[model samples]
Structure formats: structure tokens, C-alpha cells
Target: MSFAALGLVPPPTFCKKRGIEGFRSHLSLCGVVVGDLVSTSVPRPPGPVPSMTPASRRGLISWAELDFRAYVFGAIRNERNEFTDAFIKQLRLRPDKFVVVSRSETDAGQWLELFGGDQDETFYQMRSRMFEAPMASFNNRPVGHGAWDNIRMGRDVLYSTGQAGEMDITGYLRKLETERNEGWLFWLKKDRFKVKYLLILDAQPNRSGIQLIQDVAWAAMCAAGYVRGAYSIQKYVKATDALLQAKITERLSWLPPSYALTFPVSNHHNALLKARYARYQA
Candidate 1:
């Protein structure tokens, strides 16, 4: 099912002007937060939108987290058109199961707490709750001043998880090396417990932000025996639907140098550890 099936339509105020050029400009405005954070312009001219080959598209889900209602209402109708059929065919996932995290819920603290709690909560439940959660006044800029949608969804949800230093896992996401704004997706397990794939749209993320996601993702993968004693890791970037896998060898400072990789601590936590170690040495 397409976004149309979801009965979600762009608001009346959606850009009145039509055509690819207008949508491209709207996409640029939608990326204001990202551009502001990274101090770079967004949505380079809408040249031919790239397409992903069948082989590269395998194992990826066609999903995106919901933007704040205001942005959703403002999205141009044409933007709702998705290239998810291939993504679904390859992954064999249902529309609901092929879910994206949403910006509709601002108070992700409670959701994170409950989900992170020891109590038994399935991924299905988490997805369901995210879909059902209420939307709030999350747009930083006034409507019409700047666009809000995909980029805003990722920014809002990630920041609300206390990734912005309010609670634990504090650090801001740095700009990825690409010019295009991204759509988010995931690769969840068949059991629907652990997250097997984290298809973030941004490349060249901040060191700390990448570290945070890596640590959490590694923890989950380790719990599920997805990683053997020694395993290699590869990074990828999505060009349109294409998943461009990279072949490079650069060790992350926080990650252990040994072949057997270990999780890294946050920069803040690492500093505390260093201080305590120095005091102990004294």
C-alpha cells in the first residue's frame, strides 16, 4: 500500500505551484534544520532522481517515519508518491511491519523508557505505539517560513530520545556527506524483537552521533548473536533507491582496535572514566 492507502494527504496549504521544480524547492526548505545544523545548503538542483538496482535494493524496507502533522499537511501531493514496491518485494514485509519511526510523538522519553525497560515489549508493540502516538507543536520555525517533514522527523525523534544532552545518550548528529535530504527505514528481525538494520538517510554523521547509534545497534546485534567472535562491518549510502556499499578500512577511535570489536562509550562517559583512572593512578 502507498501513502495514499494510509489516507494521508497533503494539507490545503501545500505548495500551490506545481511541477518537479516546485517540489525540489519545497524539499530544500524542508531541510532547513539540517542545513542550519550542518551550516550547508540543501537539496542540490533536482536533477534526475536516482534509481536503485534490484540487487542493491535487496533486504531493505520501504518505510519512513511520519513527519509532524503540520509538515505532513504541507507536503506536496506528488511527494507522497513512493518507490516502495521494490523495497517491499525484496524484503517481503507488510506495510505496517515496514514501519518508520514518527515525529508525531514529541515525548519520546516515556516511550523510550518503557521500551528500554526490562519488561517484555515486542517490536510490534513499539511500532504500534509509535503509529498511535499523538502529534504536537514540534516545528521550530513558523509554518510557511520553512518546510518540515522527513528531516524534521529524524531530527525531532532523535533529539527527543535525549540524544541532545538532556538525558543519557547525549550528542547531536553531524551532517552526512550528501546533498540530498533522506527518507528513513529499518531492517527488523523476523522475531520482531531486535533491529537488524538501521537505514538512516544521513551520511558523514558527527563522530559522537554515529558512535551513539553504533553502540546501541551493536548492543542489540550482540544480544541476538548476529555477530560472531570476529566480524567485519561495512557502511553504505543510499542514492535514491540505490544502497551504495562502501569498501574501506578505517578504524573508529572508540571501537577497539582488535579484530574482535567491542562497544564504545560516549565521549562524556569516556572522559569520566579517564578522570577516575587518573585519580586512581595518583
Candidate 2:
């Protein structure tokens, strides 16, 4: 069955139980308690809409995290109108899972407590609760600004590998690459590693943001905690429909690398991984 058939929309229970008051209340409490610990930038942009540099249609998703520190931009749509089916079919989706995290730069201790409480739906519910208002605010802010559907807050710095300081996973370390590089050209090349990502929901503004998306997606697929399903691609009306796939693919080609973290991964991620590693190409 298709993901849509499975009712992939947000659970209605979340809507009924967590009212505006509840989300805002928690935001207030978290904001107040963590205010001294963390800081958010003003909600508006710095100036008028400057001319956008035509970024290569590639290099959107990061293999590692969601922050997208190396590249900075907002995607307007996921499907492009100009591309044809034959031209688009040559590309394969990248294979990689993003790491999702929910850390407060200000309250590391509490953030740890929230995410460390066993790997389960509670983790997502907690994060969804934490990010709900901010997410609503961020998503809605786009409406007022224009017909567009996005907004920018403060920009995040791409910290050096060593700069991640304590959160460093040593094995994943490249230790020296401090500034996040323009990843698309490097990642989407004919012969380089390929992985899509999902960012964390907090909008860490790092590649980890993509990782966060992937992490949460995996969590969602858990029919039961005991049944940790792998990522999978299905014959959806979208993917299977050539015209639709081409339109959607061309447009979303610019999605932040972490955007892939939200894709219908499963077997596809495994294949992409195998292909990139040269073990048994997907």
C-alpha cells in the first residue's frame, strides 16, 4: 500500500490534545526557563529580497546533518515545470540517513534528558511538542511575507569539526574540515558518496538538521518499537507517475540535503549506500 493509503498525515490526536494553548504554554515555559541558556534571532529578514544567485540545482541535501550551513537558501517548490520525463529518469536518489537531534544550545542538560529517555515515540512527541510552536511560527511567517512559504531567522555558523566540541562522534570525524563546504557539487558528482538526509526539527541550521529528519522518519515507521522497519520506496502515484515524478524531481532538486531524510527511504537508502561504497551498487 502507498504511504498515503497508510494515512501518513500528522496524527489527529496530536491536533486535538495539543491545542494552541498547550503548545504556546510549553513554548513560554521553555523559552522562559531556557531563555538565559539559548537565544533566537529576530523573526524578520535583514533587508529586501536581494537577487538570488542561481545555485546549481544540485547540492541540496547533506549526507551528514540538516543544518545546511555550507549552503544557505529556502526552497520555493519541490516540482519544476520545465523538465521532461526522459531527461530526469537518469538520476537516482541518494542513499544516506540523517541524524536527528534536539539540543538546546542553552540547556544542554535538559535537552539531553529529553532525547536520552529511551528511543521511542516519546522522543518524537517531546520534540514535536518542543518545536510545534516555533515550527508553526516559522511556517506561518512565510505566509505574511509573500505568496512564498518560508522565512529566515538568524544564520548559524558552520563550526569546524573540532568546534562541535563535546558532541563529537569521533568515528564520524573528519576533524579538520571546519567550514561546511558546498556539498551538492561534491555529493552529486558521478562518482562520490550518495546519501539523502532528514534534518532535526529544531532547525539547528546545520547539516544535522537533515539527519534529524531521517531519525524522526525512522522513528515514525516503527509499527511497534520492536519492529524497527528499514527505509523503503514504494510504487506511489508520485514516483510511478513519470510526468509527476519529473515535475516533482526537477523542482525539489534543490531541497536541502536533509530533505531526502524525509523521502520514502527503506530499501532505497540501503541500495544507495551499497552503490556509493562500491560493495554492491544499489
Candidate 3:
């Protein structure tokens, strides 16, 4: 559906005020017209509000903002290589589902500089932004200070992994990936699932632009992965585990039969039964 069909088209004066002539021109090239709107404000039909948990709300906010950033800046390219609009498409998300409140060039440029740069630079910057003071704290120290310092000081054991000692960052990440690819049922049974650690790992460059945007989004959703009030660790774990399952399921579906046999349906059922029995036993 078109923006006009959804009553999202802005009036000429509104577009002029926002200096969106360039965006309009770009949309025109895509065969989308924004000239039919007469009202200054877009009309919306009222509907019942959907229920959402705090973590879900935060995740949605993060996803929407990052999706908007990707949509706006996806066409830009530097001297090294040409960037493509591969984010939303990769995730199979509809572009119209996102509602961006601001489309200022300054905001887009700032986000691009923060996330679209070198991987190492992006990693540390995200660390400071998401895990350091002003964004998060526990007893006046950064919530992730212990883990961050351990990684920085080359300590083999990290706080995030609990009893999983003497493991480097690479090993820890590999373990997380293994659990994720095994599926959400496997992840639920693991004791080392920590939202803070997952956020830290999310900050690291692992995939494409989607990873960078998700890093920014997850940080924004719950800084340092700390939650209060009604938001619990279980809720955070479930939310993040859903994202992990989505990331891995795409590849799982295309695996060869030999590889597919590794994740048999019976194993999944057994895992579910074990989890339920464990919960009852507790």
C-alpha cells in the first residue's frame, strides 16, 4: 500500500517546513506520489490499544527507530563500497509498519556516524553508550563494568558467564550462538542466559547492518539490559531469545538433510518436556 493510501502524505507546506523536498524527489523516483494530501495533520482511525509488556514496548521502540534509520540512509555509499537497503528486507519486515516521528538530516547523520563506521569503533562506542555511566549503573558502578573490564584486561573468566570460567570473549560468543541455533527451547534450559551479556554481545559486530542497528536499538530499549518495576529477567530473556530464534531459524530452514537431522523434532519435544518437568520439580 502507498503512503497516501494510509493518509501519511504530508501537505506541501508541511513538507516545505521539514525540508523534505529531497525525500519527495526520491519517492518520486520510486513511483510514489505525495501530492494528494490536503490536511496539515494526517488522519488516523481510532482502534483498541493492544496489550504489551514493558520489554516488548521497548523492543518495538528500538526496532522502529533502527528500521527508520536503515530506511533513510540505506541508499548512501562512501568511497569503500556501496551500501544497499538490505536491513528490513533481510528481516522480512514491511516498511509501512514503522512510524518515524522525526526525519531530520542531523539525526540520520548522527546515527550513521555512530553505527555505520568501523566495527571496532562501533563496538566500543556502543559499550560506552549502553554499558557505561549515565546510561546504566549498579551501586554507582557501571552494570557491565566487571565484564567489560575482564574482557579489556584479558581475564579468561567473565562475569556474564557465571560458572563458565576461563572462557574468552570468542568462546563465550560461540557458546551463545550454539545455544541460539539449537532453538529457544534449548536456550530456556540454560542457566547462563543473561540479558546484560546478550546486550553486550549485541553491541559487537557479528552480522551486517542489521546487527549494528539492533545494537543501537537494544541499547535504547533497555540500557545495559537493566529493567525495573514489572519487567523481570524472565521477560527480558524470553524477548531476546525470540530475536535469537528469528536470526537462526532463517538458516535452519535451508540446511541440508544431514545438518537438519542434528535438530530433530523429537529432540525439541523432549527438551520441552524436560523443561516442563524441571519447572514442576522446582
> Which pairs of residues collide in candidate 1?
11-73, 176-203
Error of 3 at 257 (Å): 6.1
**Per-residue alpha-carbon lDDT of candidate 1 for residues 21-65, written as tens digits (9 for 90 to 100):** 222222222210111111112223211121222222444322222
lDDT of each: 0.23, 0.24, 0.27
Backbone collision count in every prediction? 2, 48, 0
Query: Which sections of candidate 1 miss by over 4 Å?
Result: 1-78, 88-121, 124-157, 161-167, 170-282
Is 2 or 3 the stronger prediction by lDDT? 3
User: Considering TM-score, where higher is better, how would the candidates rank from best to worst?
Assistant: 2, 3, 1
How much is the lDDT of residue 241 in candidate 1? 10
What lDDT is reached at residue 139 by model 2?
A: 29
* Per-model RMSD to reference: 23.8, 23.1, 24.0
lDDT of 2: 0.24
Candidate 2: tens digits of C-alpha lDDT, residues 198-234: 1122323223223332333233223112122354333
Instruction: For residues 38-140, write the lDDT of model 3, one tens digit per residue.
Output: 1112123211122222323332211000101112111111112111123212222321222111111224321211222233332221111112123222233
TM-score of each candidate?
Answer: 0.17, 0.18, 0.18
Which has the greatest lDDT? 3
In model 3, which regions exceed 4 Å deviation? 1-231, 261-282
